[model samples]
Target: MPEHDDAKADAKATGAVTPQGSGRASKRPARSAPAFGAFVRKEPVRAPVRENTQANTPVGASTAQADGLRVETAQSWPADAVEVGAVIEAYGLKGALKIAPHAQGGKALLAARRWWLLKGREQPERHSAVRASAKVHGDSIVGQLAGLTDRDTALLLRGARVYVSRADFPAPEADEYYWVDLIGLDVANEAGVELGKVADLIDNGAQSVLRIEYPETGKDGKPTTGERLIPFVGVFVKTVDLAAKRIVVDWEADY
Candidate 1:
């Protein structure tokens, strides 16, 4: 992160405003619009699977069940290789299953040609015995695993999670970042003063704000107190260096 001196120099060179004092203030003002293509908010629907469900339940669990579904576990890739999506319910006797993806983009699930199906883990030996795979069908996706040739077979897979590796997805463009990448980056002001780590990104329908976990430090190098919120807008953000894992802002320490 750039220090206070560096920030002051940059502001002077660029003719931008610099906040005085600790910059801590009563409240932060509203931010302006965002630049095109910038990831201002996290995906609203998709998230990690929760624990404490039925024993052996798949990672990405769902309740939409039809008939002809089959379940089994995968073994070829590491845990992170595939993220879990909703399970397949039988579509019809011909052996089709309905799939609900976690993200709006189904590219990750579509790219992975194979899948391991498992029933809940209560019967690990039996769950491990099943195997299945799928293929992309135009906009929607379809899967056909071993022994799942009929509606009855497909119905058996209901509630099973669909997993795919992070590598299966395409890379993001410059200035555009995935919500997962920004979650823990350190946030600081242009003056090189420490603020806080990004606790999370909150969406307010209009825009997103960074929930900073403020640090407790005074001029005496002692802990002061309190936290703050900073809008992740281009006007306030000077630069975001993903490689360095830091965000330099035009904000002041006070407010």
Candidate 2:
């Protein structure tokens, strides 16, 4: 794995190769990237102005109808909008089931009114849809799906995945972002030099880090790429704007 400093040096030494996202690069005159280490100001990523969806709308609003339940085809949901949590088997006879969220921010699960369940298998298939309401149960969450009303019914939900809409989530505080919000954004240094797209976020217990993928060309138009991991600390990351789908960092093109 390359470090941020190594990436900067590679970019500067190479010159004006294809910008990072182009998935191609060629030897060319090196351009001096912007000085991003100086400006520490934060900026909003500006969400597109749109009329707010109706407040009366239910959670998983697109799936709902006049009958108070909605069915969502797997194809209809945006990949970024779904969250995965595990159902830890039946809690009791009342159709309630134990849930373990995939993240510490799991409390967001209880805050939403409805969830989509898909059972896990050797190869999980999306089937047997259910609508449910959730509430916090000690350190975990417990919820009742409309069709599950007994231990036997709940047992069927064991190891099921819980999918909730991003819209159902509460607004994050300033300087904070949900991991999903940051996953696909373009990252750049203050100097406006492109780094790479955010490939994944890793939680190393103490803090989160972003994995960035950098593309390189090899004579031919085909590109090869490498990855670098950067800590998501205030010192490294200056601003994150999900609306703009970009992350501005305090790093240097040659860092």
Candidate 3:
């Protein structure tokens, strides 16, 4: 989950925002994001899903068509939805929302539209449904919704999470992978020595690193778990086979 402790911090402290499948979690010192794609806020929210873009529409007069029959259907959050970001503040005088994404060193939230507003970890199910029509600002994203207008309404959303169904994520290009996709694969070395399974990953400014966790049986014959912080760069990582659920690296178990 994204750090909610700083959710109420001023906008000036807004740093690099996370993008879906584009960034990892932060476990080390992370650098600010470079200037990525920024656009003016005037477009629609829904990015065409390769699977079914129109299938998961929201209910509203916004979707109502001419002759008053129908248009799009509003979608609720999926059970396995992944928490992507949090509401930072309202942008402009409109219903635009400012978000701090959880994908460390990434800008994945910029591509998200349909979002569920959860009031922190205590609020299990979503409390509200809103569509996002946003643009990338400095290090965060500013967006707007149909019913959500003015700073007062935005205030009600502070610290609320943004989630997209796991199935809603777009397929990555070749060689690129989603952080969620690599979460559970096994890790090994060049010589076929088993290391551990992927517990998590982090963004250390320069690149993404893998946090592989496994059981280590020490010389005392006692078992202890350990974590390996392997750089996800070309120098350390070799092949990542999602189909095989394994990553073959140029690293050693002892290292």
Q: What range of 10 consecutive residues in model 2 has the weakest lDDT sum?
A: 35-44
TM-score-wise, the better of 1 and 3 is 3
Model 1 per-residue lDDT tens digits across residues 1-110: 11112212332221111221222244766454333122232232322344524423332322212222222344543465443355545555666655554433343444
Clashing pairs in 2: 5-255, 15-30, 34-191, 36-190, 63-70
Error of 1 at 226 (Å): 6.8
Of 2 and 3, which scores higher on lDDT?
3
Point out the worst 10-residue segment of candidate 1 by lDDT: 11-20
- Which 10 consecutive positions of candidate 3 have the poorest summed lDDT? 35-44
Kindly report which residue stretches of model 3 are placed more than 4 angstroms away from their true locations once superposed: 1-76, 104-107, 128-132, 218-221
Candidate 2 Cα outliers beyond 4 Å, as residue runs? 1-72, 75-80, 120-133, 137-139, 217-222, 253-255
Task: Give model 3's TM-score versus the native structure.
Answer: 0.66
Off by over 4 Å in 1: 1-84, 88-97, 111-149, 203-209, 214-233
Give lDDT tens digits, candidate 2, residues 1-255: 111112233322111111211111356543343221110111212223334343112223333332233445568654645554677657777767677765542444655556766544463434333446664554455666665566654554455567767776555434556666677789999889999888877666545667888788767778888677876766567677778999987566554
Q: Each model's TM-score, in the order given?
A: 0.50, 0.63, 0.66
What is the RMSD of candidate 3? 12.5
Candidate 3: C-alpha lDDT: 0.55
What order do you get sorting by lDDT, best first?
A: 3, 2, 1
